[model samples]
Target: MESEPTAELIRAQLRRLRLAANLTQEDFGKQVHFSGSQISAIELGQRPFDRLFLKRADEVLNSDGLLLGLLRIAELHRQPHFLRPWLDAERVAQQLRCYHPTLVPGLLQTEHYARAVIRSDDLLADDEVERRVAVRMDRQAILTRPDNPPILIAVIEEATLRRVDESFRGIMTQQISHLLDCVQRGGVLILVIPAEVSVHVGHAGPFTLACGADGDWVGHLENHLGGATIDRAEELATLHARWDGIRSVALPKGQSELLMKEVMESWSTI
Candidate 1:
């Protein structure tokens, strides 16, 4: 098997190719339609380069698609090793069932909300936060993809909708509004487990089960340290039972939307 490309490897190749072509960063940037500083940041590994930038750079550097190829392999390995399996399953899932007691499901989170959530850790540097946020936003594509997007049934606790981050004013409102928008757009169903039913199985933690096209299900469980991909039959069965318990208490689609709107309005007042 071919080795996955590393960030350092890509950066080194870019610098070497530019030097070999006898072109300064400024000159190369001109050809690639990027600013010299932007190119500098990419070469220095200070900025994350997307596919478009890599393709343009490859063309300008005459790398014969080398850079683009590296980017494709690098992206597949960019996510944390622990998450790669679950991410792979998520992309091809036919349906997803998720339950969250503390925050919105990652698949439905807006960029701003995602950034705030990742930043809450306080241990990660700014760049790491941005990177994780980008990965999360990318994962959301499965819901909107034109080619058979997965149907998402997300059960979120009512408290999650009302939780406020005083530091980030109006973040909750924007997030809740985004959730409402997602439901309106189709392929997503947001169900709220009202606070009145304070005790429930979902209160144990958050988990997601991805149902593949063939009807096989894989489960993912998360915690502060990291997460685990669960495929064992007994574990999957437990997850399915928990999901049913959570869904049983959650408000139906219509009531959930109304509840979200009420919380959003309350947030607007704060």
Candidate 2:
């Protein structure tokens, strides 16, 4: 197991390098296409370091790839405890397949829905909650950005689509609308499994499978008890079969979008 990376160390290094280069935070921000405040937030450990920022810092500070190297190590250690390995796999995956029996997948969750989901973990402090929400939102970047984004296919249960919170009706509406927009964009696919499906492998729980460009595959299985990432070929094969079982019964993209529209419209009346 690799030791967790320390943000404080990176912060110290950034401060030293920037000063050595005689660049003020504002000057550095200008060079990196970030606002001074954003740069300050990163140096203060209030915001996470992104690859782009580190790349710019490396160039501006003449440190070769030191900042980027730090970021790579930092990325591995900063994930929420249980999600560490899955995140590592996600960073390099060429394809992502997610099947959720209830609730939205984190990658597709709207900001409000993410907050609601994170708040469910009562043990987290307010700042920690906000930090997690930011992390989840940031993870969505994988679906876009690069010229070739990963192929993202999600199969959500009918119950999840129909589920609503009266207090957050507006937010739910926004979420559904966002989902609709996502499917419209290339590289994303959304399917819905109806409530009537009597038997399916997904009935066991939600799981995500990530396939790397190099042909490696991993499965992250999650339920109420806990979660684990399975890399064993035999275990991944089982999960792959289960995904096929659930996906086979799921509604096509057209129908799923129609159902999603209905759900979005329902929120308008509330």
Candidate 3:
């Protein structure tokens, strides 16, 4: 006798099977006639775990009836918990506005890129590294839900795009390619702040604004140590204003994707 399936449980099993099969979300999505974003939404529990999705996931993973069976469970166990408030806000956010000056936001990171970032500190054990990476990847689902995905408008620094890491040859290629695909897919808007811009309010730090369905909004900040959520309307309003300033300095989507393509092509030569 299995417990009823909750969103979390279904997402976990889906992620596990996908990882075990060594398939990227894009590749997995192709097999099921779904976009990578849609697959991501299902895996992150941002989208509903409908039977149609279960049927496709079952076919794609070669899981037979395992996924559907898991969906029938009553209660599932929890995954490692961190950033409870922020994660909660993201889960129901109707709109997302962000400015990242240092690195690509977690929601847009490729698995390889994410793995590199996760292991950079060199403090976590192997298991811990895997867990953190998985959690971060799961958070990206907010951008891919089949219905009512939060409108994501992110402005990243030009330097952040050019910053090369150890995985330049393989991971960078994948990361840029994934970014390109996301941009072309149209669920999110990504802007790049050119290096030529001398000064901007974004110089302070990275921040994200998540607006919930009920019109409530929150500001989010995350760093190497940890992350927190801000619910004060005044504070969130200020963050929103800052984000507007950053976006004003950022390149338009067409130019940004063109820059991304140049970088993606450069990775091949490296």
User: 1-270 in candidate 2: lDDT tens per residue?
Assistant: 112345677778898999999999999999999888988988887877755677788998999888766654655466668878888788778999998888889889999999998898989898668767766776788898675678999999878877777787887888888899899887889998877886777878889999998889999988665589999989998999998898999999998888889878988776
| Poorest stretch of ten by lDDT in candidate 1 | 1-10
Per-candidate TM vs. native? 0.81, 0.76, 0.70
Name the runs in model 3 displaced over 4 angstroms.
1-82, 165-167
Better of 1 and 3 by lDDT: 1
Alpha-carbon RMSD, candidate 1: 4.7
Tell me which residue pairs clash in candidate 3: 3-73, 3-74, 4-73, 4-74, 5-73
Cα misplacement distance, residue 173 of candidate 3 (Å):
2.0
Q: Best by lDDT, which number?
A: 1
lDDT score of residue 116 within candidate 2: 91
Among all windows of 10 consecutive residues in model 3, the one with the lowest summed lDDT is: 72-81
Q: Top TM-score: which candidate number?
A: 1
Q: After superposition, how far is residue 259 of candidate 1 from its true place, in Å?
A: 0.6
Candidate 2 Cα errors over 4 Å, as ranges = 1-5, 13-76, 80-82
**lDDT tens per residue, model 1, 1-270:** 112347778888999999999999999999988889988988887777766677788888789999866755566686679888998899999999998889889999989989988898988998678767766776787898999999999999998887776765588788898999999999999999998998998889999999999999999999987899999999999999999999999999999999999988877886
TM-score computed on alpha carbons, candidate 1: 0.81
